[model samples]
Target: MKKLLFLLSLFFVTSLYAQVEKVEPTFWWVGMKNPNLQLLVYGKDISKNQVSINYPGVKITKVNKVANPNYLFIDLSIDSLVAKAGKFNITFLQNNKKFATYQYELKAREQASANREGFNSGDVIYEIMPDRFVNGDTKNDFVKGYPDGTDRLNPDARHGGDIQGIINNLDYISSMGYTALWLTPVVENNASSTSYHGYATTDYYKVDPRHGSNELYKKLAEECKKRNIKLIIDYIVNHSGKDWWIYKDLPSNDWINNYPDMKICNFRGTTVFDPHKAEIDAKGMSDGWFAESMPDLNQRNPFLATYLIQNSIWWIEYAGLSGVRSDTHQYPDKQFVSEWAKQILAEYPHFNMVGEVWLNYPSMTSYWQKDAPNLDKYNSNLPTIMDFPLHNAIPTAFAEGDGWGDTGMNRLYDIFSQDFLMANPMNIMIFGDNHDTSRFYTLIKEDFKVYKLAMAFLLTTRGIPQMYAGTEALMTGVKGSGDGVMRKDFPGGWAEDKVSIFTRQGLTNDQIEALDYMKRIQNWRKSNEAVKYGTMTQFAPQNGVYVYFRIKGDKKVMVILNNNNDKQELQTIRFAECLGNHHSGTDIISGNALNWTNKIEVPTKSAMIIDLN
Candidate 1:
């Protein structure tokens, strides 16, 4: 009879309360720069309970219960200086009776984690769209209830390129002299369609099972470390997938902007900084949903703000990432995103994060960089901004010969004249083409000479250079047909592929030559500090020839682009300012050492790079 009574009591306790459904961050570490931490607790009727933590140096500063009965935002003051790495119970009670208890752990951070350096100008970045890269595992091709599954024939569907795909190709990647790898979002996306892009995130903490588990992602980072490659994650904070757990059951209506009757964003980054802009225009850019499936986040909501910020920190720590590439960076709340960057930098001092400021003009892109002299006194605190202005100008410059206003080489050099608008010009990231655009070869009408000229210019330019995966193979696609065509599968990534770019099997002569040329230049770039860190000096367009010099303390390299149809004799006397006391140099491209006699003959539609002696 006593045993029956004890069993009945145990049943009552077990049935009455379950462990808190979710504790975001699940755990945290001691010795963080910020002593305060906000934990978003989600569970059934969780708001009705009183919360208490029993841990040394861990104090529950405040417990916030929103309109939702299932969500609790608990603020804790973690005195890292005194907090020991251990676990303790966080008890939830109702009517002074314990109902739920969660055991949370505080961990010890990795040594020197705070001092980890981010990707910079010294590194050449290889940008990849993972789903189209390779199929590393077939088992994860179709995750149950994920909506989108592997379909190689369907350009918009997932193709089963897991993190293991990236791990398996580290050799090919590093062999191309790429020091940093930037992949589009690998986070979980449960959207019904076109989920291969990975921008809409359903789960922030978990890597999409379709891509592989979060552990596999960390393993990818570890493998990259073995090969001296830095991993940069493409992170999105502006909005989340409509299927996101938080979006489905919002903690509060304001957690997401324009929740039920959401409006589309104006897609104008200028609205954020336009002094004469209408309030509606500014709000439209910030509050409007990025898309029907991407519900915009309200960073103004302190709880949501803390959630996003903490998530960024969590991923950086958990994955050991070198940097973050924030997608749709200009769409979030102004002041809140500023603070978001502030907090992340406070934790990782030397870290670098580039904003995706996809503006048409340099002024617009520069405005979001770390320090721009804006009339409105706005500072984005973003370490780098994509050089869209230059990327837009390059193909046009290479494709068109001597022409009017900002045409030909003029279009290329004219963009740099606006450099005064940039606080740090070196922080810009330049790319000839990316996943969303037409390939460089396609843009140049498949002119191999022009392709080499354009690539040589981008590689030798003043900013950090990022090359999209298939650029070297001269992959061709036009952007107007849609992103699907623009982001085609990398040849030979799958077993069924007829030809593999990986092994140079059955490649066209142009494709093989382009690949070898890019490999040569990129490998050489790895050793040339002048091109990476030197001050750039450009010469005015002279008869379809553009010249530039990258000069360091005593190191100098000269780049000449001949966009003409005839061989041109470039007078050396005109570049005396850049050629101080040097009469001879080795032309690295041809491996020919030439002694200048006031002029050098450069082939038409070709690039010449000289290492000064």
Candidate 2:
């Protein structure tokens, strides 16, 4: 009889262990704007059991079950006004018999979390691909269970950069006058190869161990906060890695867009706003997978939509993020994107979100911004959209000399003229090049003169400017060489690195000059109110020079770009409306006193930022 009892006990224990496997968002916080919480419970036939919560001030509003018996989405309503931080018991019952119990906790939020400020026009964002930026903790470089390991020699292989590396260099970033740091996604990307980019997310809630733990990521944010630097997470909502848990054991066939067939995306972003676009084309663009390895998420499914929305909010509240850079923003369902932005903004009113809308035209890009006057009457509710139109114009403008309408500075002038279509042009995130494109230095053909000109325009322009990690250090790489070439490791990020730009050691004179020039302009921009939140007045390109003024209440900044191969005299009389009574000013770059009454001599392929005193 004792042996029989022992066998029965063993069977019961095995059944209990098999009941539940995972509970996402392991814990939540009280006092959230939205009291409705959805807890995704994953286990073997866990959906077959009825769930209930007996905790004080917490009620199980509903239990949703999908076609797959392995999943259960439990909705809970926490009384935000009176909910206290404590552990609560969630019981799972099968056939009126207790099978498994989950002890969930609700924590108190940080002070002023809902009112946390996001990165804005007053800030300059320094974009870094963590894997290529630095490797602070070599111990976590090659994690077990992950197929691909670090191989710095191969441009396409992981180079072992981690969150600790970023934390270690917070001082370096802050000293450079950058107010915000935007890292490419650090989420778990357990792909067989090319996982260093961090765009293909395998786990929504966990940071890849190779990058660092989720705790380390939070610590990175805290460290950034101490240095007055905001962290902008590059979030991907359109797709997930093929190895994603949900992809392996989908809750339903509709969990992913294309499912077994895996239709590659059309990548025609313009179809989103094409009024007369065919229904088939629109569906193909939105429903198509980004790649074979990245499965497209079916945001049209309410469960998946809610899951993604909650996951984003969870990260913001958990990590204390300043902002979010939505990857492939237009590829997701239009309505879902609108709702996602609206909900996030509703919770954190001061937060900012910039979407990656890769359209080459200003009008189409403008249509994605919040409150845009779209003829189709769709509101994206997204505060910012990337300035791809300006991005396309920059290289062309610098490459060409003066022309009537389309060449030289006219290219930029024509682009900015359509800023009227945008609800708020200043909110656009402007960058010369990013990880996917050729480096800015290479785009300008490694010409330091043109590089300086591009920097001046980017920093002084009427938008939030972002600079890639090594751009200030004169890093050059062509996109044709592949993305890994563009996102090469930062020199001196590793101890083995012979040359470190982080310090002045082992740098060419041109590199040092570029670094110092960038620092000076960036620091100057930090304190200048006119450049930060001023109204812009740009004059047409004349004699190969593009002149613009950023004027606020009592402050004014005049920027001149001479793109010619020869010196040009900029007439001061034409800028009388902006120059006003100011007879003299100091050039921020050369520290020369300018006589506004006479023509200003601008050198070939040079830029001048004048403080109108």
Can you give the TM-score per candidate against the true fold? 0.97, 0.97
Error of 1 at 8 (Å): 8.9
Cα lDDT tens digits, model 2, 1-613, are 9999999998887667567788877789999999999999999889889988887789988999999999999999999877799998788998998988777899999999999999999999999999998999999878889987899988888999999999999998998889999999999999999999998898999999998998999999999999889999999889999999889999999989887888999987888989889988999999999998889998999999999999999999999999999999999999999999999999999999999999889988998999999999999999999999999999889988886668999999988899999999999999998888899989988888889999999999999999999999999898898888668899999999999989878999999998889889999889999999999999998878899999999899999999999988877889889988988888999988888566788887899999999
Candidate 1: RMSD to truth:
2.0
Clash count for candidate 1 is 0
lDDT of 1 at 388: 92
Model 2, runs deviating above 4 Å? 1-18
RMSD of 2: 2.3
**Candidate that would win on lDDT:** 2
